[model samples]
Target: MQIDAHQHYWDPARGDYGWLTPDLAALYRRFGPADLAPLRERAGIARTVVVQAAPTVDETRYLLGLARDDDSIAGVVGWVPLLDREAPALIAELARDAKFKGVRPMLQDLPDDDWIANPALAPAIEALIAHELAFDALVFARHIDALQSFASRYPSLRIVVDHGAKPPIVEGPAGWQPWADRIAKLARLPHVHCKLSGLATEAAPRWTEATLRPYVDHLLASFGPDRLMWGSDWPVLNLNGDYLLWHSIATTLLDVLTDAQRDAIFGGNAAAFYRLEV
Candidate 1:
């Protein structure tokens, strides 16, 4: 089953997406399953994992409801306030739904870069590990040290690095070493996974394959196909490119690999990581 593992759906009317501002003109409107179905069909993606766009539990529940009915949505990586003292209870409550496959605490939005390393958050992390749910890490390069520490503390927890940790693409290939070093360090942990998603938005205007190939190659070398997965990043991807564009570039980057390796990066790894029924 071909899975676009990290897409999002949101309603501007919901008024909960604090980050969905007028500055992001293209993404300020509503995006629903109907809009995505055709794109997925065109891309030949049979299933997708809808991830959270807002940090509110209300939004998470909204996505869960969507997952319950949409056969195309294999699972959801929703959000909960992991730093909250009641996080474990909230995680337990949400996990009761078979469609609630994992949790993501919009760490990138949080002011503190070390938010994931808090000892106070241990119970919540442990709860996720106990439940065998995935943790979708929404972070940037600055959070790498904390992520490494967290991965060490919870050796069994399943973690997927979103957007290749949002590399400094605007700065060009010369600026890749710091992010590459950190990614290499994170990939050393067997429990962690990385996504080839969202990088198109990070590039300079009219970016080319040459702009992303370096970062993609570094990640492929670090984690290998079995530990890596691909995601459309969808509406947000519309900022710089579209599903087809990203897919085309990603496919080109993986073209040198054996078919099995390419299949693993595109679909198999996502199905296994998210425990999707597809």
Candidate 2:
């Protein structure tokens, strides 16, 4: 049940990915299930959850198609305008499709505190939960309070905290104290889980396990093994290093934990958290 719980796919020329332009033009790499398959084989990843990168339902449906056709992709987490009046309809529409396991709104760009608290987002969120869907919190440290609010409001609905609350370790973990405190608060919420995926990318460029140790340790301690999962973040991690580099960093970091804890961090937790079919 080794699941890379958070990854995305996109055909840049085919659709509107507002975040795929300009400064990131170099990252417009052509990728899909075919590109990831070899990497999965090398890394021993039996399953993957293709998370949403596009801002439209078309991308969600596309990934669903991939899940139907590609064995590596066991589940999908996509995007939806949480505050849109059409959210419920949108969720219902995607629900019938059967591959979309959840939704994520890219709250990272939104103002820290109010993004997830949007008043009009309830209908869609409720619809998602009713349909047995999950929500991936793509938020930053400043938004930790809002994340807490979100988890409290939707206690029964599962929520995954992507990127370990996105601590700014480049400035030292101390700078992330308030955010860490808030994250610990969110961890206490039985519904919330954290992904141990992108910690290296968040640290200084020449990052190593020692440099990344604090953040990883804090999260595992805060979220606990049962609620923690791992993700590759993949091509995005190309920003830090190649896939093997990311894998090596994760492996070295977990060397000190027990086998069961390591298993949960790498696969077990993702299987349970995302309910992937392994």
Candidate 3:
């Protein structure tokens, strides 16, 4: 089963997406399963792991409600106020729904870079492991060290670094060292995985496959095919490129690997990592 492991569905009218502003003209609108269905069909994608766009619990429930009715949506990576005292209860409640596959803390947007490494969030982390849910880390290169520390602290937690830590591809090969080194260190943990998504948006607007090859190659080297999964990143993807373009580029980049290895990166890894029903 070919799975787009990370994607999103959002309605701006609901007024919860603080980052989805009018400035990002192309994506400042509602995007749901209907809009993505045809693209998925074209890409031979059987299912998708719809991730949360807004940080509110209301939005998480909204995505879960959508997943309940849509078979195309295999699971959802929602958000909870992890810092709150009631986080464990909220996580338990969300986990009651089979489609609630994981949680993403939006670490990149938070002011504290060390937030994930904080000891206070232990209860919430433990709750996720106890419930058998994964953790989708929405971070950047800056948070890799903290992420590594957190992953080490909770060895049982199944964590996937969303968008390969949103690498600095736009900065070109010259700026690749520390980010590459940091990612390699993070990948040393067996519990940590990564998604091959959102790189186009991080590259130049007219980015070619060559512009992204080095970063993609580094991720493959660091995490290996078994630890990597492909994601469309969708509407946010529209800011730089479309679903088909990103899909085609990713496919070409993985052509060097054997069919089984490519299959793992395309779908198997995501299914195993997210614990998706498909």
Indicate the worst ten consecutive residues by lDDT in candidate 3. 168-177
Clash number for each model: 0, 0, 0
Candidate 3: what lDDT? 0.93
TM-score of each: 0.98, 0.94, 0.98
- Choose 1 or 2, whichever is better by TM-score: 1
Which tens-of-lDDT digit does each residue in 179-251 have in candidate 2? 7788888898888999887776677788877888888888888988788888888777777766777777787
> Candidate 3, residues 1-278: lDDT per residue as tens digits?
89999999999999999988999899988899999999999999999999998889999999999999999999999999998999999999999999999999899999999988788899999999999999999898899999999999899999999998988888887678689999999999999999999999899889998999989998999999999999999989998899999999999999999999999988999888888999
Candidates ranked, most accurate by lDDT first? 3, 1, 2
State which candidate, 1 or 3, has the greater lDDT. 3
Predicted structure 1: lDDT: 0.90
lDDT of 3 at 52: 93
Q: Rank the candidates by TM-score, best first.
A: 3, 1, 2
1-278 in candidate 1: lDDT tens per residue?
68898999999899899889988999989899999999899888999999999889999999998888888989999988887899999899988888888998888888888878779988888889877799999888888889999988988889999999999899886778688899999999999999999999889878888888998999999999999999999999999988888898899988989999999988999999988888
lDDT of 3 at 208: 93
lDDT score, candidate 1, position 20:
92
Question: Model 3 misses residue 20 by how many Å?
Answer: 1.0
Look at candidate 3 and give me any clashing residue pairs. Answer: none
lDDT pick, better of 2 and 3: 3
